[model samples]
Target chain A: MFPTPIQKRPVAAQALYQGLLPIALIMWLLPLIAVALFSIRPFSDFGAGNYWGWPSSFEMFHNYGQVFFNSDMPRYLWNSVLITVPTVVGAVALSCMTGFALGIYRFRGNLLIFFMFIAGNFVPFQILMVPVRDFTVSAGLYDTKLGLVLFHIAFQTGFCTLFMRNFIRALPYELIEAARVEGVSEWRIFWYVVLPLMRPATAALSVLIFTFIWNDYFWALVLTQGPNAQPVTAGITSFNSQFVAQYHLMSAGSIVAAIPPVAMFFLMQRHFIAGLTLGAVK
Target chain B: MSVTAPAVPHAPSERGWFQRNRMTLTPLLFLLPGVLFFAVYVVIPIFQSFQISLYEWDGLGEATYIGLGNYQELMTDRAFEVSIWNNVKWLVLYLLAIPAGLFIALFLNQTVVGIRLYKSLFFFPFVLSQVVVGLVFSWFYLPREGILNGVLAFFGLEPVNVLGDPTLATYGIIAAGLWPQTAYCMILYLTGLNAVDPEQIEAGRLDGAKGIRMLWYVVLPQLKPATFIAFVVTIIGALRSFDLISIMTNGGPFGSTRVLSFYMFEKALSEYGFRMGYGAAIAVVLFLIMLIFIGYFLWQMWQDEKEARR
Candidate 1:
């Protein structure tokens, strides 16, 4: 609206605007498009120096089949799903209680506790790297999916609490007060009253956290070792090493590693954007 | 007496301590699991890392206490200096994503046909893992097989090896990082723009403000929240720039692309042998730098809380 809508413009200008949209999008996504193009090409195309040319033959099914059946990709994918689902559930459930307490109750140390979560959330992961790893190893949970999941659930709680608390703060307070006056216990107020109203926030946070844990590379690298526990982000590196410069297979493998989160985003775009832009609108 | 006895049983004095103290106890009860987890995994480790930084340890055996030894060594380490300078460069250059995002947001703000689909497509990059983005860009910068070289040949210009050259490698990785970052900022601005006050824009238009002037005076003032968020995320993202660097360059072509985050990983982990103490020291430095921003952000939030309370 600020730019003066194209509908109000001259025919020539409108035509020019429409034509420019596709070009700009193409330029913006060129790198990804290139990878996508590479994914469908046969391995022979790279050897023949047909890098950007039309694929001599399309090997989409064969290349993807090889990635799924021949490699450790499926195991890594399963590992990612295993790690991500529990983290989402744990982080969300924990944050819901924390959010309810901070949003509904007036208590000493509330702001201090909330600020601690925020500051912890912002600290660099490197600061936590050595100590967290040492802690994990000492607890005898090292190099296991459970180790990664527990650490993720704990770390993600900081961000999730920030989000959930803010969201619960914006809810109508009278509903809570009414419940309290009716002799409903505090726990019941949270379960029956506050929890149902937090569905949108829960959905938004869940989608966001799922994508986050799924795409996590740093923790997956530090806490886990081999395909037995590593997520797809780290696994793709080994997948590439196994294939080396077979660009077609490597391209296909990378794309496959990236699909779950992308699909999550598309399916839950509204919630994803809502979660991300929670503080953007004041 | 019997009527008084039934009334007494229903009185506050007869309630259990748990019921009487439920108001205070409920919050503490709900907070227990989250607080415990956060303490173990996040809070306590922070203090532990600080303690570890003072000792010289190989992560496997006994640690020796050498007072500030790692920090003293860091003063003379050339790789550390390069990493610091590159971090400065990253902090400054990564900010370009904000304005670039605003520009793209403005370009796509119109309600053209299929605009929703277009918007989603434009935002697709941000959803991809940085690993994928790094891999995609690395191939895109390949000296021989890269389309960038192909494009240069099409224009009859010489092809340059972007990731292979030390001078250009850092910039190449930053550019890759900016791709997703810009998309993130664009979405934030788009959402902000959706909520802008139309009446004020009309008022500005009536006053003869047009285009850039209109944007500067009218639109941008309304987009402050989005801008602040963009600034926060971009700063944090710049500091946390490990994934792209690790995947794309691995601090290679002469270690030209290492930032503090990546360097810290290399020292403490990797096949470089585990110098846990030294790595913790590097992390401490990075933590101190981040603390400045963290302090400022918390202060702002505190001020906002006060205003809301008022």
Candidate 2:
């Protein structure tokens, strides 16, 4: 509105604006388009030095089939599901309680504890790297999905708590007060009143956390070494190293690795944006 | 609407003794699992990491307290120096995303057809995993056949080796990083722009404020929250830039692109050697750098909390 919408501008300028939009988008997505194009091509295309040229034949099914059928991609995908689902559930469940407590209560050390969670959320994952891995190893959870799930759940609780607290704070105080005045127990008030109202925030958080844990590579690399426990994010990179010169195959795997989060974003676009743009609007 | 008693000490239950102290205990009960998990994994580890930095250990044996030896070595370690410098460069250059994102947001803020799809497509990079991003860019920077080089060749120019040269490799990876970061910042700004006050903008317009002057005197001030969040995320992104470097260069061409996080991993976990103490020391430095920002973030939040209370 501030810039003056192009429709109000001269006819020529409006036409020019419309013309430039698609071109800009295409140029912006060139790398991705190239990857998609490459994903469908045969490895022979790479060998023939026809990298920029049209593929002689499209092998989309064969290439993608091999990625699924021949590789540990399925197991890695399974590991991602195994790790991410529990993390989303754990982080969301924990944050709901913490968020309810922090948002509703004004006791001493409340802000301090909230700030602790906020601070920990912002801290680099490196600080926890050596000790967490060592801790995981000592606990005999090393190279296991449970180790990754526990670590992610804890780390993600920081962000999710921040989100859930702000959301819970925004809810109507009277409803909660009404429940309390009815002589309902505190836990019951939270259970029946607050939890039912928090469905939207919980949904938003679960989708966001699911994407985060699914795309997490650094922790996957640190905790898990092999296909047995490694998620697709790390496994894709290792797959890159393992299958050198198989750019076609690697591109297929890249697309496969990217699917879940992409689907999550597309499916939960509004909630995803809501979670991310938490502080930007107000 | 506090669970705490407002006027009288209202006792709900007489059957269970827990009702007598429910006010003090209820919140704690709710906070227990989250607090316990966060304490063990995130909070206590800070102190443990600091302690680990003082000891010499390869993680399998006894950790002898060498007391600042790793930090001492860091002072002279050239890779450490390069990593720190590159991190500084990453921090500085990454700030470009703020202005770049604002520019894009301003361009696309208009009511256009398919604008939603356009915004989504522009934001597509952010949704992809960094590993995929790294792979895409590595291929994009391919010397002969990559699209960037292909474009250069089409223009009758020699293809530049982007990721191969040690000096340019860090910058190359940073460029790849910017593609998604700029998109992220743009989304933040677009959201901010949506909430801007039309009355204030009209007032500025009536005063003959236009273009850069209008943006500077009016819009930019209104955009402080978005800018603050953008700064926080970009700084953290720059520091946490391990995936790109690892995927693209792997600190290659004589180890030119090692940020502290990636360097910490190389020291502690890589086949290079398991210098856990040295890694912890590096992590401590990174942590300290982050503490400065974290302190400021907390201070800002604290001020807001005070304002809310008031």
Candidate 3:
């Protein structure tokens, strides 16, 4: 209702606004548009420098097939899945506890611990780079999906805890007090009372964590170097090196790597937005 | 899951530690797994990096201690200085997202048909990974054949080799980074706009305030939470910039696009003989810079907590 609506604006302004909207969007998405177009173009057409022109043929299926068959795309995808799934479960489960503790209870070192988690979450992963890698190697977990999973679980716990705590803190205290007065055990209160009320928060956190782990490039690169344990993000990098100017195949591979997160985002659109904008609007 | 003792209320002081702090202790049990992982993975490693900075080792060999030598090397390393300076530029230029986001939020805060689709399409770039974004931008910035170059040729200008040109390459990568970053900022601002009180806008309009003046004097003040969050995330994103730079340039054209994160990766890994110590030093410096801002944010949160308690 605000901004007087486009219909209520001057006719000239409305016309100008409509015209500019598409132009602005096109300009903004120019790069993505180019690559998406290129992905369907035949290699011959691409090699012939007909990038901006209409594609000579639709080779998207062929290009994508080649990425799947020739490269370690499946293995990489499996590795990503192996790492991300456990990380989501570990991070969410861990944060449920941490968030509950920090949110519901008052104790010594409460603020100190909360601040530490927050501060730790914001630090660059590079600081943890050497030590984490060494620890991974020493545990003989290097070049294994389990290695990446362990590190991710640990790292994500920081952000998850912060988010979870804020969410749990915002929950009404009266419900908790009422449960306590009824002689319901603390664990039962959490499981039956608080847990059900936390559905939205849980959904939001799950979607966000899923995307975060799926798209993680830094740790994937740091922890694993080969396709044996490499994730899609790092796999895309290696594929980039091998393909070298094979734009169609690279584009196809890029699209493949991007699909899971994009799908997750679309599927959980509400929760994704809710999670992302948690503190923003409030 | 234990039976409760019959209600026999006693003096609060006489309660055992377990009873006295039962609520807090119970939660800590839940916190143990998370706190332990956080400490091992995030907290301790930071100090570990600082310690690693003092040693010289190719991860496989014994680490030889060389106190402050890496810092000395960093002092004279032109590549280090240039990368650090580029990071400064990235931090500053990347901040344009905040205002740009607000502008877009205002533009889209209308009850128009197909506007929801428009917003989603605007948000498309953010849902994809940075690797995809990098590849897309690489194609766009390619000489002669790239869409950007095609547009340039239409205007009678020769093709510019953006990625190949050392001077322009960093800017090219930064631009790519900005695409998603700006979308993220816009989403934040949109949420902020949604929460803006209608009555306040009505009051402002009745007072004859309009356009930029209305925004600056009224709307923005109400959008403080969104702005604060946007600022925090954007600054952190800028500092932790690695993916786009790695994919697009690989610190290329003589490492012109090297930010600290990528540079640290190159130093510790890649074909650079794994100077983990030196890499850790670079990381430590970046962490120290981030720590300053993190400290300020925590202080503000603490103040808010104090006020809430009162």
Candidate 4:
């Protein structure tokens, strides 16, 4: 509106604006588009120097089939799901209680605790790397999916608590007061009153957390090893090494690794954006 | 009604201490699990890392008290200096995303046909993992078969190897990082723009402000929240740049692209020898730098909280 809507512009300017949109989008996504194009091409195309030309043969299924059936990609994908789902559930469940407490109750150390979560959420991962790995190793949870899941749930709680607490704060407080006056116990009040109202926040946090855990490379590298427990982000490197210089296959593999989160974003675009843009408007 | 009335009188007399004090107990009970987890994995480790940085250890043996020996060594390490300089560069240049995002947001702000689909498509890059972005850009910068070179050839200019050259490699990776970061900022601005007051825009028009003038004086002041968030995220993202450097260059072409995060990992974990003490020391430096921003952010939030309380 600030630029003056195109509807109010001259016909020539409107036409030009319409034409420019597609060009800008294409240019913006060109790098990703290149990878998509590369993924579907036959392996021979790279050898024949047909990189920019139309693919000599479409091997979309074959290349993707190799990733799914022939390699350890499926194993890695499964590891990612196994790791991500638990982390999402654990982080969300933990944050909901924390959010409820901080939002609903007046207590000593409330803001102090809240600020601790926020500050912890922003600290560099490096600072925690050595000690966390040390703790994990000592606990005999090293190189295990459970190890990754636990750490993720713990670390993600910081961000999730910040998000959930803020959201819960904005809820109507009278509902809880009414529930309390009805002689409902505190736990029941949370379960029956506050929990139901937090659905949108829960959905938003779940999708965001799912995508985050799935795309996590640093933790996966630190806590896990080999195809047995490594998530797809870390596993993609090994997948590439196994097929070094096979650009088509490597491209396909990386695409496959990227798809779960991409699909999650698309399906939950409303919630995802709602979660991400929570602070942008206000 | 009679049964409920009879039960009400008995309830308070039969109530235990837990029921009598549920108000105070409830929040603490609910807070226990999350607090425990956060303290163990996040809070305690921060202190532990500080402790580890002072001791010389190989991560497998007894650590000796060195008392800033690693920091002293860092003063003379060339790679550490390069990494610090690269970090400074990243912090400065990465801020370009904010303005670039605003530009894109303005360009796409209009309600043209199929605009919903266009907005999402424009935001596609941010959703992809940084590993994939790094891989995509690495190939895009390939000296021989890259589309960038192909474009240059089309324009009859010489093709340059972007990531292969030390001088350009860091910039190349930063550009790749910018692709997703810009998308993130654009989405934030788009959302912010949606909530802008129309009355103000119309008032600006009546006052002879148009285009850039309207944007600078009228629109931007309203977009402060979005800008603050953008600045916070961009600064944090710049400092936390590890995955791209790892995936694209691996601190490559003679370690030209290493930032503190990557260098810390290399020192602590990589095959370059597990100097856990040195790595922790590097992390401590990065942590101290981040603390400055963290302190400022918390102070701002504290002020906001006070205002809300008032």
Best DockQ among the predictions, by candidate number: 1
lDDT string, candidate 2, B67-132, tens digits = 999999999999999999999999999999999999888888889889999998888689888888
Which 10 consecutive positions of candidate 3 chain A have the poorest summed lDDT? A1-10
lDDT of 2: 0.90
TM-score of chain B of each: 0.96, 0.95, 0.93, 0.95
Which tens-of-lDDT digit does each residue in A116-165 have in candidate 3?
98888889889999999999999999889999998888888888888888
Better candidate number, 1 or 3, judged by lDDT: 1
Worst 10 residues of 1 chain A by lDDT: A1-10
True contacts preserved, each candidate?
A: 0.74, 0.75, 0.79, 0.76
Query: Which residue pairs come into collision in candidate 3?
Result: none
Pairwise lDDT winner, candidates 3 and 4: 4
Separate DockQ for every predicted complex: 0.83, 0.80, 0.77, 0.80
Candidate 1 i-RMS (Å)?
A: 0.8
Candidate 1, residues B140-174: lDDT per residue as tens digits?
A: 99998888898889999999999999999999999
Q: Scoring model 2 with DockQ, what do you get?
A: 0.80
TM-score of chain A of each: 0.99, 0.97, 0.96, 0.98
User: In terms of DockQ, which candidate is stronger, 1 or 3?
Assistant: 1
Docking class of 3: medium
Model 4 over residues B236-301: C-alpha lDDT tens digits? Answer: 999999999999999989999999999999999999999999999999999999999999989988
